[model samples]
Target: MTQVLGIVDIVWRGRNIPVEKGAKFRLGGIKNTAVTYGRKVGRAQEFQGSEVMATTELEAGQRWGNTWDPGEGELQVVCDTGQTFVMYDAFLEGDIPEITGGEGGKIELKWAASAPEEIGV
Candidate 1:
């Protein structure tokens, strides 16, 4: 039988964020291309992933924005198939996560990576 792959969790700055069930989790496929003319002309490769929902606690008389801004550090996504993706130099891209009143509650955080990530099995 073939084993299925599943995203176990999303860890940032050494913290395991509680992700919502059925949340959107996608890894942007590795891409390579060459630029004909531009500022930086050369072959380039990119590695990125979709937003990783991070569970948060909103309390009354509390603030948002900078207070909840996840500075930057190593971001990891572990899979059930013993696959791990590590973004060595990564930081929070967007200013703040989307806010809305609905099911449970979740914050969508962009997995912005500066360079190629290290894939381990």
Candidate 2:
């Protein structure tokens, strides 16, 4: 079966926290960043099957190693899910970014894949 996936854009607002040596630290939101992409599969699915079919990652945004100085305020991120998230610690080097808001933070993600082309065998 063939299927088409629609592209999605996300937007949110929150705070950015800085961490040292993997230890959590508190920081108020003073930065602004954004991420955008297409539909993606959930990470939990990886355990469901031996061979992973669909996988996607985040791109076109700030990286983890790259230091961001939001500069005296708070930080917020807008995602495709339509839920605004306040970032606590941004792990840019990994496959995803860890964000927090209100009670706590969760991982935010985006993904995309090209439609396969058919060729006569």
Candidate 3:
């Protein structure tokens, strides 16, 4: 079966974090930014995925992403075929959780990256 850019394994700042199976991740053009809409790829009959990403937790030394902070870090979306869509200097947009809901309290996270690099599996 040919992979069609579904099922993403996220690698934020080199840390691997896999999202829900129904999660839908998309990357924009060079001028545009990358965004991951939680919690599903498209609207069919699926619930949104929780645990979209890691957020604020100082004591845990876990504050390198989400929060829309600029750490010049990398946000990688590893595809099912092992193809990785890496974004350098990626930072979450201030107003995340754009959806704030989608019938089941689902949300959307927007991210901005300088340039995106796609690697083959």
Candidate 4:
């Protein structure tokens, strides 16, 4: 089964926009091996009963003005290699600068073979 390695929350700032919770979000891997966009995309590729390690969760809420703050929640996701990544409570809008603006964040993950013994098990 796939397992999650790490989760990092992200916040992208747009013209006249605030980083809020529950906003449309997407995630991709550094290896360019996996890429997910839109809610539909995320839902289509959610974790499948895998016991993966997650450090943080997705945030929730809405923007009222120029600023938005997404609280935090798990991003139900299964890595390309049967691993699941469920981010917990941190913002990760620094990985994808093109999408999340110049600021980037990341959610690190690894397969059972590549993961550290402390996390991969």
lDDT per residue, candidate 3, 1-121, as tens digits? 7557656677777766534556545554523234558864533332322122432222234342443344557888777867777787677665534332334333344456644577886
How far residue 42's Cα lies from its native spot in candidate 2, in Å, is: 23
Clash pairs (backbone) in predicted model 1: none
Q: Which ranking of candidates, highest lDDT first? A: 1, 3, 4, 2
Which portions of model 1 miss their true places by more than 4 Å?
A: 21-30, 34-67, 116-120
lDDT of 2 by residue, 36-105 (tens): 4466433321111011011123234645333323322222332233433333333333244445444333
**What is the per-residue lDDT of model 4 for residues 12-111, given as tens digits with 9 covering 90 to 100?**
2322122233322233322322456765333234332222222222224532332223332333333333443444332333232222223332223221
- Comparing 2 and 4 by TM-score, which wins? 4
Comparing 1 with 4 on lDDT, the higher-scoring candidate is 1
Q: Each candidate's lDDT (Cα)?
A: 0.61, 0.28, 0.53, 0.29
Candidate 2 global lDDT: 0.28
Scored by TM-score, the top model is 1
Q: Write model 1 residue lDDT over 36-108, tens digit each, in one string.
A: 6666778777765444434544445545643256666777877778877777666777666666567444456
- Model 4: lDDT to the true structure: 0.29
